[model samples]
Target: MRNMGGEQVEEAVASAVALLRTATERDWETTPAGRLEWTCRYTAEHVAGDLIAYAGQLAGRATKAYVPFEITLDEGTGNEDVLQVIETTGALLAATLRTTPREVRAFHPYPYRSANREGFAALGVAEVFLHTHDIAAGLGLAYEAPAGLCADVLARIFPHVQPGADPWRTLLWATGRGDLPGRAPVTEWRWRNNLVVPAERLTLQGVTPAAATDLAAGGDGGFAWVEGGPFQGTRDAAGMLLKAYGAGVHRPEWGVFVLVRGEDGRAVGGMGFHGPPDEDGRVEIGYDLVEAARGNGYATEGLRALSAWALEREEVTSVFATTDPDNTASQAVIVRAGFARVAGEDSGSAEGAEGAEQFAYELRG
Candidate 1:
């Protein structure tokens, strides 16, 4: 997967400051920033505040809430001064992203309650891009961000929004800043960071569409995997995830998760649901561990945690799974995770493996 970190943050901030510098002499205090209620000056200040706040969240390793601090520009601060503040905070965020470990995640209350380094980086760049557009629009200055940068942010945070012909415009529309043909106007929106569910020894890190694409294409999906990792089963699941995302039917919470060992921060396997819960509130799940990582109870622990998490949700009544009848190891893992064998099937003279005999299990809420 493409890197989404300090470099992207710096590039976005530099681009924003460079563009806004041309109009520093304009009356920003009196001009409204695009469709927003805030003036250009306030919007610029907001950008700086967000950058510093995100940096603080990671630096402080805050887990329950924001860092309980804010940045403020002194009274009579000129537009140039505001731009400079933005640059400084942007640099601070970039530095934080560089220093933070890939496994480190801090407080960020969106759809989930935390975000990792790449998540913070994406949010910082997004703030710079969207607000810069606002300020530029208010000042009548031309502004456009790199297409790739916009696309990265979209894939990382705005996964629910379908890919449009133009990523920048799609981002603008997704955030209620503009419009797109055939899509309803966005009156309310929230950017989602992928979910991470904690277990005794593993963290089930939710995989994004970008990561799924890479994994499906024979890549690491940006994770440090154990030897013999991401076996064919994992790759097959990733392909399914990519297909769902491409069809615009993927839900982050109901998608694939990489089982990362907390002790070493290395991925041991993949586990996740096939799709969202159906009308009966039942969802099917699947998992596979690398050969070297199997027989360690990692799969059992992951299944238990993930299944419990699913049951906690009001929309989910049960979690289900299936395996080849002869797969005693997997069946043992599922039984250990509290699933009961509910059914069995056999197909005689079928065309493919899908027609083979299988054992089905379920864990009810």
Candidate 2:
């Protein structure tokens, strides 16, 4: 996949990008921001723009080591000329990669630049991976990149790949763009893509359905309809996830939430798993009541049923919760769910990348 003298990979990248970029213009008019959101446009522009930047690096331009850019991007008006730009750039990349000698040290804006054909080829793969996702997501289009290309990106850029994978989860985590506990302590999380992302590097965009319900859950109108998850992030949420995941950032680990909506069934509360799986075969209780739904027993009720189901089938040994120490109301809800505080900081709970301190507590049978 790395050797580039011929035009195969370059042509492939060009063809794929052209179609995706074109579709972007057609779809931009409908989004909330009219221009499909500023970031969307910037990302597409960045794809094209970055190539020019890479060209500079390869040509031995005397510039400072290139800092990686994780800015939000979209295909702006200039993308009207995307086809020519792609064809030209793709060919240039193809030519250089194919002819460039093996031992010549070529520079890439990325810190770990190598001039060999394989290095450029890998960069091509990474560019395609990042750019294609922008175009496809921006256009609300379907995308299935060649598995080989994605593999290259994962391999070559593994160290630089940002936190918060699980594109589905990244939606909320990314969208909220909150300060998280610095590098999540590594946890074993199997992603929908079947990639087990390192725990410390997760980012959230939207709460994913699988992250909440069984990845297999489905139905039209049950007593409770499940929504959100990595798979369903096809909406605005997915974009949010992509922007952050594309750049390394922290994402918190938590669980399967069922949105409890209003009479009209608008989501008013969310109930899901919390706490990392413990040595005792237990994960703590986790729930969120939207502002409108708070002051009720909804959290307690949901926890009661969920706890039993988990214990019976999963053989869970215990559960835990950590809330703001001063949030007496939520504390009451947790207490009602049959959990007792195993620890409470006299100074409150631990201060993490999440900004404020949280009071950590646990519940066991």
Candidate 3:
């Protein structure tokens, strides 16, 4: 995806700065910050510290661990000074994001051990919005981040959480800070970064919800594509992803992924599962290559890699696909990936057999 990093970071900081500016004269040191053990003063400093730390990680490109350093307020610094620090540190992060390359990844231990500039930006924004709420709630001042900003952060970092009509409230609930109707209150949570699988000549980069939304709207989905590529099938897959996500049943691991060329990082195709494995331990898979990238075996490589990954999971015992009977090229690609064509009875079909012209293929664990 195109990494809306710099823009998100700046918007989050501006929101916090505006809210905190009104309460600068209050006694922040002794006022407890919501449910936290620390006071409002400490929470404000924490925001600044995180902004600067993320900027440092991106700027230094630390791959193994966090760069061992810290930011501290000067002795006798007041609440106003802390807010200034936040603004300054936030700007630093924004600048760092602008300079960082789109493909550059740094250390961040979550579901994955590394994150790109976009991930860090989303993380930084989450901190600002959540903590600013804590301070605002404690001080009895009203605060609400923009709905669009909340959606961006949730799409980028909180992909596992189902979206709601009110993005701000849903975000707070997902992070254990608030509650939503008909849902259990969150006591603990962790954000998930999208997963990427590597093939011999291509990388199956997982599509984030943000990218899916864009692609569904006929945009480029933040990927650099080879000329005249990202064919209709890829966009259809993206639309499916968005529908599943909107319904709150989307699983990131089972979602669509862009086939990015290893040599140049230009996207050449798309591949993914239809959904999680069904009761019978079977998952349907799909793929498509850009016209310019066709006949290069990219589809076969990606299919093999994704199918293998799915079979590695305990829930998936088999991977299956279907292609038009006349599309011999697609049939050959599936066969080359080690799938056996199911016999003419249409017995292996996932959807009940209504059309006899569609050939079914399967690969067992």
Candidate 4:
């Protein structure tokens, strides 16, 4: 749950610059960057450009698109000057990350239209790490970024990739930079920023595998929780999410989401799918709120938003849930969210429930 911003950007940039400075005299303009057509010099410039651009996004708070400006070196700028540009740009990004509030999100065009501070920081780190490897390979220099740094980057941005024994290698393999045993070669890839679904009073923020791991391990999962928040059920759901991620079957959008109250940005609960939709396009969802946040109807609002989002997807036809027969509050929440009750024998809940008699509910598309 540590913050993955600020000084981390500086560290990544400094590491890359230190290594590249040693080979500044080499013919960077002619040598191609690893697996890319761009020259090593061009690749290095791209890294600096991305760092500055991400910094600009956070600083400008642009929501609809990238800011209409870019960095361009002088025509005669040397390799050493380029390295300086990277250092300067890296400092800007680090400063921006430190100043941006945790709740702020800006434009980033990957799987989502926007990314938070952590997302931009991770992306900047990744650009530095991966491109450094490319330039080193092209220059015949040994290249190995710190494993912890690589792991942090993967957890934040590469949630779709299952963790491997060596984080550095796993990152390379995930982005088609290398290969791994027992997995298909990655010919195409993209880093997915976590999705944020806004509702009237709550925002269901998609839980990344990294957050799930932290939550399962008794941490806050990087969220500021309300007093008496993130109840036992939320922790249990995070454990389930961790398992699903480890098995490489967790679809991020269909996994756990923490419900953050809009007024205070304090997390009140957890809610999301049991897994992806079944063959019948049916997906089971579960949720819970802390004692202090319960009566405010946060659960109902989150369920309504999340269920509506799922049902709108072409792969889902219905959403389902189950509660103890006596848990009338939960039943009311589901009912208010547009779910209808069904007989246990006719409900999908018949297959499971820890052997307790359960009331089933369904919200069909």
* Candidate 3 residue spans exceeding 4 A from truth: 1-3, 344-356
- Which 10 consecutive positions of candidate 3 have the poorest summed lDDT? 344-353
Task: For candidate 4, write residues 1-365 as lDDT tens digits.
Answer: 86799789999988899899999999999999988888999999999999999999999999999999999999999999999999999999999999998888999999979999999999999999999999999999988988998988888898888888899999999989999999899999998999999899888999888888789889999999999867888889999888977888778988999999888889999998899999999999999998998899899999999999999999999998988877889989999999998775555455355677787889998
lDDT of 1 by residue, 108-202 (tens): 98989999999999999999999999999989988999999998998899877787889999999999999999989999999899999999999
Ranking by lDDT: 1, 4, 3, 2
Error of 1 at 102 (Å): 0.9
- For candidate 2, lDDT tens digit of each residue in 160-189? 235333432232123232224444433332
Q: Over 4 Å off in model 1, which ranges? A: 344-353
Cα error, residue 176 of model 4, in Å, equals 0.9
Worst 10 residues of 4 by lDDT: 344-353
Per-candidate clashes, comma-separated: 0, 46, 1, 0
Write the candidate numbers in order of decreasing TM-score.
4, 1, 3, 2
**Model 3 TM-score (2 dp):** 0.93
lDDT for predicted candidate 4 compared with the true structure? 0.91
Note each model's CA RMSD in angstroms.
2.0, 19.8, 2.2, 1.4
As for TM-score, the candidate ahead, 1 or 3, is 1
Report how far off residue 259 is in candidate 4 (Å): 0.6
TM-score of 4: 0.97
